[model samples]
Target: MALNLNDLQIFVQAVDSGGFAAAARRLGMPKSTISKRVAALEADLETRLLHRTSRSFMLTDPGRDFYEHALAALIEAEAAESAVRQRHAEPSGIVRITASVPAAQFFLSDHLPSLAVAYPKLTLQLHATDRFVDLVQEGFDIAVRNHFAPLPDSELLQRQVSIDEVILVAAPSYLEKHGFPADPRDLKNHAGLLVSQTAKAWRLHHVDQGTISVSPHCRFIADETLVLLRAAASGLGIACLPETGCKAAMEHGQIVRVLPGWTAGTVATSILTTHRRGQLPGVRAVVEFLAKGFQAERAATGNVLEPLRETTEARS
Candidate 1:
């Protein structure tokens, strides 16, 4: 294989920018040069790095696996240059981060932009997905997840970002038409709108360790929280949704919580990352900033909604 420093750099740039032409623009290089370099690198490895098609460009399985390391190498190299230029100043380099969909909408959408405005020299690469990805293996300096636990690998670490709240609600109008259930079992008569791609019985927990299962067989299930929230807001039926996802509708009083006595667990939001190599200027900077930003966000959230508002049922 003929993979070299330049080839790796080209691959890293393409992944970060999401396309060859875009990477070329970011690096201020000719598109043809970028393509030639990437093609050569793929040829050297005798494996396709990317699955390029007319309307889209995506990393192949090998490409996705190789991307993480390439990203780390490029970041370290840039950090070196930035350090030499600064002399005695702080570290400055590109920091790439990833987050789940809800986390991105509720937290990053605002915070990342503010951070960019504050640090003009800092280049931010943020990607949003609901699926979890390996932070170290994927070359991302930071990955925010809603349900994360400590990884056994000592090289990696995680810190709590926030405690998300999950609440059950239905449109006020719908409740009026179909009398609200006084007990959890009473919901059998009403149509339920569950969230997910497949049908699963909804579960609820009581403070007394007693659990109740509710199945809205005539339920409408959506894959996205946003879709679920809108459906519930329109009085589709009852749904157990995350507080972070339904905060807006609740604020407007379009949907009201039912069986406030029950509780649901949202797991916990966390930032997954590797501890650091001697001096990973870029990754370290992003990690520090993220820790501080999430701490502030968690503090603000506590005031907006009580953390232990209710117990939640875990969905499969």
Candidate 2:
């Protein structure tokens, strides 16, 4: 049966405050109004909850029983409200996040130690996979997606956190053995460590010559970037890689940048959330931390990471 919570509250308050007159003062209402609401509550329940005389009142058998349950219900309801408020106010609890394996390895896992230090009460569960999963059904708090083009329409909130310039790279041994390519078209002669996500033709962009598409002789192909990076480092072939992903290898002299003036493309990383507003503090904290961490990493590497912006979900 449906019960009016307001009436239940009023009835409880009227009884606890000793009388309608006292409850009226506490609630800042007329005594008659309080009496009428309490009476209405009893009428709805079809039970006499109070026996009253000129100046005194007492609870009947059913009244005592109802009062106990009503008081407990009110306490639990208030506690539920308080719990939500508290959770919203503080960054705590577990945040389940998902991202591509390379992103999780290079972009995300590194910042976790500091994030834990900052938010000691919060825990993050990382799920690394290449396939896209439904954030709501999968119970993910946030997702990191890297794309070369605009993402498809989604109900989830999308905020771009970082942008990496895609660059061509190869082990120094490979370049020394095969000679460096002076032109984008020359890549067709050199072996290629291709990424499965890209088309057969590698489309590169140059400032003056514009975009050039080269169908290199692929020696190895993999969907995961980490594998391609390793293959390129081993001098298997020249591979296209994000500047950020290959930064360490370049510094360590394991690989060198190829076609210095040309870029393969640009890939942007974005965070997706189920709801932009009223999110749990832990979820919001993770999102902000990831955004800042990516931006800071790009800054240190001299790459321009674009500022965060909310995306509009396109509808068909």
Candidate 3:
């Protein structure tokens, strides 16, 4: 019996992805359909393709040989399809992305919906989290992150799209109650809403002068930046926040800048990917847009670029 091409394709996905269920997920097909297709492939070939175990799939010798052959054929088939698509397709494909909460709200939320409007054919899937996202395993096309430095690994190709200033800000009322310290040194006495994860020690930089390292004796630790921003705005305490996260409140007079001259460690937000040259049209478009988008907004807030190059290099 001759094997159907589609069945063979399903078999390849099953083998590559390690199971029928995983293949179904990757192919966006039903698990039952994937299982049935693989079974049909086995019957057509007159041999059992996989030796099943409790938690793993093992290929028989013939199955292994067939897998190699079928995988090559699948690659050729994909290339052919891609070539045809390249000629006729618009920028229409699933673009899976990941981003931090602050970056997502401040940077992407408005832009992404607008992007969908511009490219009606394109489908965008966004995954937002404060914790690290593994691009390969999570199947993410792009990751927007707060980059005080380079990506943890060199495998990810990253571009500096936005510069988010880490600044000391507090509610005007809070300052009134606690009394504004004449300098950065007095911050130790105030109720500091410290970001427990990202900022451990504060690096404050003066425009004309230099960097001053300050570590506040915090009364409370905010697990997330939003919590930190809200608390600071509500006059609970002072916080070191990225300018984008606080820009809206800052502009509306909800929160006021605490230390005008002192700058905390400003992080450079980056778009990360595995593609070295950034070949994907969607990825390229977003990256270019972010690069220009954030840079232009710098004038409104004095978020000047301070290259965390030393940090990135050290990590790499």
Could you say which candidate leads in TM-score?
Answer: 2
Q: What would you estimate as the lDDT of candidate 3?
A: 0.76
After superposing candidate 3 on the true structure, give the runs of residues whose Cα lies further than 4 Å from its correct spot.
1-89, 197-201, 207-209, 215-217, 302-316
lDDT of each residue in 1-316, candidate 2, tens digit only: 6777777888888888889889999999899999999888888889999998788888999999999998898899899998688666869889888897878878887888889889999988889987878888888888888887887886878888788999999999999999999999999999988876366678899989999899888799898888999999999999989999998899999999999979988988888888643267888888888888988888898877556676656210
Write model 1 residue lDDT over 117-178, tens digit each, in one string.
76677788999998757666778877777762433434446565566656678999999998
Q: Kindly report which residue pairs in candidate 1 clash with one another.
A: 1-44, 2-44, 68-139, 263-310, 263-311, 263-312, 264-311, 264-312, 265-312
The per-model lDDT (C-alpha) reads 0.72, 0.85, 0.76
TM-score of each: 0.61, 0.72, 0.64
Regions of candidate 1 where Cα sits further than 4 Å from its true position? 1-91, 148-154, 197-199, 277-282, 296-316
Clash pairs, model 2 backbone: none
- Residue-level lDDT for 67 in candidate 2: 91
